[model samples]
Target: MIVITTPTGQIGQQVLERIVDSGKSVRVIARDPSRLPQRVRDRVEVFQGSHDDMDVVSKAFAGAESVLWLVPPNPQSGNSTEYYLNFTRPACQAIQSLGVKRVVGVSSLGRGFGRNAGILTAAFEMDALIESTGVSYRSLRMPYFMENMFHDLESIKSHGTFYMPTAGDQVLPLCATRDIASTAAALLLDESWSGQDSVPVVSPDSLTPNEMAHVLSEVLERPIRFQQVSIAEYKATLSRFGSEAWVKDYMDMVIAQNEGIYDDDLQKVQPSDTSFRTWCEEVFKPAVLAP
Candidate 1:
C-alpha cells in the first residue's frame, strides 16, 4: 500500500489520481474526508487528521510500503520552524517504526540555501529532518509554481498590470504543479531507487514577468503590463494580508530571487513540454473566462 499526505491539495490530488490509475492500493491523510471528491474517496482509504498528529499518522502508515509526504504550508503558525519540526518529528518516527521503505517528499528549490530564502527556511529544515529518518527518499526540489501567478490575476484583469519585485528582464525558474505531481507519482510507483537524494524539477525555459505578460496578452487579446515594486512597497502590500514577520520573510524571498540567489542549474533534468504560454492558453485563460 502507498500512503499520501495532504491529498486534497493541487499536487496531492493529481498524485492521488495518478496512483489510482496505476491500480495500486492507496491511502490518504486528510483532516476532513468529506472534502475529498467523492469519486477519489471511493477508490482509496482515508485517514482523517492533520500531519501534526503522530498517532493518526502512525495508524495510517500500517501496511504501507511507500509514502508520498507533503508538508502543508502554514503561514499563520506562531513558530513556523517549530511547527514543521514538531509535525515531521513524529511522522519520521512513525515511518521508521512502520518500516516503510520509500518516501517522496515535496520540497522547494531553495531548500539547501540557508536563510537566503527567508520563509522557505522551514522547508529546508523539514527536508533535513525527514532525511534523517534514513528511509530511501527523494526530495522533489521544485521551482516557483506557475500557479503563484494566479495571485496577481485579479489585479491584472482589473488594472492591466502585474507587479513584482524582480526586474522584468530577469528570468527565474518556474514549473507547473501538475508536472511536479506527475514526477512525484512516477517516483512513488518506481521502488528501485535507493538512498537519500534531491531532484530539481524545473521548466527548461525561464521567462521574465514581462515576457509572461506578453504571452498572457497574446492569449487574452488585451494589453497586460509588468510593474516592478520596491521591496518596501512589496512588504507593505503583503503586510496587509499577512503578519509583519511573514511579510518580511516573503519580501526577502523576492529580493533573493531578484538577486539570482535561488537560481538552479537546469541541466540535470529535461523540462516538461508544458510552456507558460501553453499553460496560460489552456489553463489560466479558461479559468479567467469561466462564468
Candidate 2:
C-alpha cells in the first residue's frame, strides 16, 4: 500500500492524480475528506484526521509499503521549527514501528547553509529526524516555487508589479509544484533506489526578479515591474496576519534568501522540467486572465 499525506494540497493532489491509476493501493490522511475530489474519494481509502496525530498516522501507515510525507504550512505557528518537527516526530515513530519500506518527503534547499533560515531550517531538521528512522527516504529539496507568485496576483493585476525582499537582479532557481509532484510520483513508483538522499528539484532557468517581470510582461502583454521591499516592511506586512514567531522566522528566511541560501544548490542542479517563461505563459498568464 502507498499512503499519501496532504492529498488535498497543491503538490500532493497532483501526486495522487498521477499514481491513483497505477494499480497501487492508495490511502490518504486528511482533516477534511470532503475536499477530496469525488473520483479520488471513490478510489482511495480515507483516514480522516491530521497526519500529526499519532493515532491517525499510526493507523494510516499500517500495511503501507511507501508513504509521501508533506507538512502543511501554518502561518500562525508559534515556533516554526517545533511546528514542523511536531508534525514530523509522530510520523517518524510510525514509519519505524509500522515497518514502512520507503518515504518520499517534500523538503527545501539550503540544508547545510548553517544559517537560521526559519522554515528552511525547519525542513532541514525534519529531514534529519526522518533519516534517523532509517527508512529508505528521498527528500525533494525544492527551490522557490513559481506558484508562490500567486500570492501577488492582486498586486500584479492592479499595478503590474510584484514585490520581494531580495534584489530585483538577484538570480534564483524556480520550480513549479507540478514538477515536484511529478518527481515524487516517479520516485514512489520506482523501488530500485534506497537510503536517505536529497533530490534537488530545480528548473533550468536561473532568472532574476527583474527577468521574471519581463517574462510576465511578455506573457500577459503588459509591462510589469519588480519591486524590492525592505525586510522590515516585509516582516511588518506578515506580522499583521501571522504569529510573532512566524513573522520573525519567515523574515529570517527572506534574509537568508537575500544572503544567497539558494545559491549553492542553484549552482549544482536544474533537474526540473519547467522554466520561468514557460510557466509565465502557461500557468501565470491563465491565472491572470481568470475571473
Candidate closest to the true structure, highest TM-score:
2
| Maximum-lDDT candidate | 2
Q: List the residue pairs that clash in candidate 2.
A: none
Residue 82 error for model 2, in Å? Answer: 0.8
> Candidate 2, which segments miss by more than 4 Å at Cα?
none
TM-scores of the candidates in the order shown: 0.94, 0.98
Model 1 RMSD vs true structure? 1.7
Query: Worst 10-residue stretch by lDDT in candidate 1?
Result: 260-269
lDDT of each: 0.81, 0.91
Summing lDDT over every window of 10 consecutive residues in candidate 2, give the lowest-scoring window: 263-272
